[model samples]
Target: MTKSYVVRYVGGPLDGRVDTLPDLPDEPRSTVTHVHLHEGPKIVHHYDLCYAVEYGCEYRLRADADAE
Candidate 1:
């Protein structure tokens, strides 16, 4: 049997504390994992970086096991 879960992201100015999203596609489920900055390309520029830093860049996505 396959297990399901809800992925919630804690980000943006609103804090996204109450925001939650469901994962689709039953074949494969989504899971959260840590990523290094060097692993991906740098997209944030001067303004974007400053805004993100000032507002706090602590967006954490947690997967909560769904109750079946």
Candidate 2:
């Protein structure tokens, strides 16, 4: 199976520095294995996009779909 996702810093200046969206992890488990993607989400984004998947968290991503 395939999935979409993104990765971002835990909490820093680059925090929420989304760009790598729609990442298909080799296996989506409690811990991610790899993240070999860095592109915008597959949607009409407006502002910025990012995701967080660390420190006891799931693959939560953010995008600006409001923009066209």
Candidate 3:
């Protein structure tokens, strides 16, 4: 099975967004991650484009799960 990575929004304007991706690059540029949020107990997946900073930003990059 293939592993996937996801970005969990902890703060900022893109809060409450959990996006999944197959792989994330280590370049200094902007990448889009699908933002998923729930409203009124309804699961809403917002394919919102979010800018990720490699140097300075409130967002961060980390492993979605343990790789085996």
Candidate 4:
């Protein structure tokens, strides 16, 4: 099984506390970690880096998130 997670980041004018959601950037600020999970178990393995979006453009923003 494969799942996707939206990587949230705290940068730009919004630092310290996160009271509102941040806007997406224009280029990749960090490595985007894709993952794959087995059917028998819920454990997931780190897959690859999504360098570009569907439109072939790179997103610019650091993603700070840990899997649960």
Candidate 5:
């Protein structure tokens, strides 16, 4: 089975949300994409991995990416 890690979102609409995701690389920094429905269009948001915790990782919304 693939290893799963607890991921915590730090900012944006998903702030404070936690999810268990599989196969997140153990890198200091990385990007995760999220798709959401806004009105009738699908919007994509990018988050950057910023911190590592005991058993999880913390990702913050990218200001530049979120602006797009």
Candidate 6:
């Protein structure tokens, strides 16, 4: 079975959202991109990896890219 990890998103519109991702490499991507689609156009949010926790990792939304 493949191992998965839980990712907690903090700040921005996606704050408090938790996602399950596949096994990550020793050095995971510094940032994660999320495409959000609501009623209108799609907005992209970039989250930077903060630190590792017991179960998985936590990512914070980048300030520069937090405009809605």
Show how many residue pairs clash in every candidate, following the order shown: 0, 1, 0, 4, 0, 0
Clash count, predicted structure 5: 0
Tell me the spans in candidate 6 whose CA falls farther than 4 Å from its real position. 1-4, 20-24, 52-56, 65-68
Tens-digit lDDT track of model 2 for 6-36:
5543332344554454665565444322333
Off by over 4 Å in 5: 1-4, 21-29, 52-56, 65-68
Error of 4 at 5 (Å): 17
| Tens-digit lDDT track of model 5 for 1-68 | 67777788888789989888676755645888889986888877789887565655688888973347
Can you give the TM-score per candidate against the true fold? 0.20, 0.25, 0.35, 0.21, 0.59, 0.62
Model 2: lDDT to the true structure: 0.39
Any idea how many clashes model 1 has? 0
Mind giving the per-residue lDDT tens digits that candidate 1 earns over 1-68? 54433333353322344323353335432333433356678332111111134332224443233523
Worst 10 residues of 6 by lDDT: 59-68
Encode model 6's per-residue lDDT on 1-68: one tens digit a residue.
88787888898888999888787767878899989899999988899998766646788889883355
The most accurate candidate by lDDT is 6
Local lDDT at 19 for model 6: 80
Indicate the TM-score of model 5: 0.59
Q: Give per-residue CA lDDT, model 3, range 1-68, as digits (tens).
A: 87665555644446665767686646523433434565655432223234456312324333344544
Per-candidate Cα lDDT values, in order, are 0.34, 0.39, 0.46, 0.36, 0.78, 0.83
Provide the lowest-lDDT 10-residue window in model 3. 54-63
Model 3 misplaced stretches (Cα beyond 4 Å)? 28-68
- Worst 10-residue lDDT window for candidate 5 reads 20-29
> Residue 27's C-alpha lDDT in candidate 5?
64
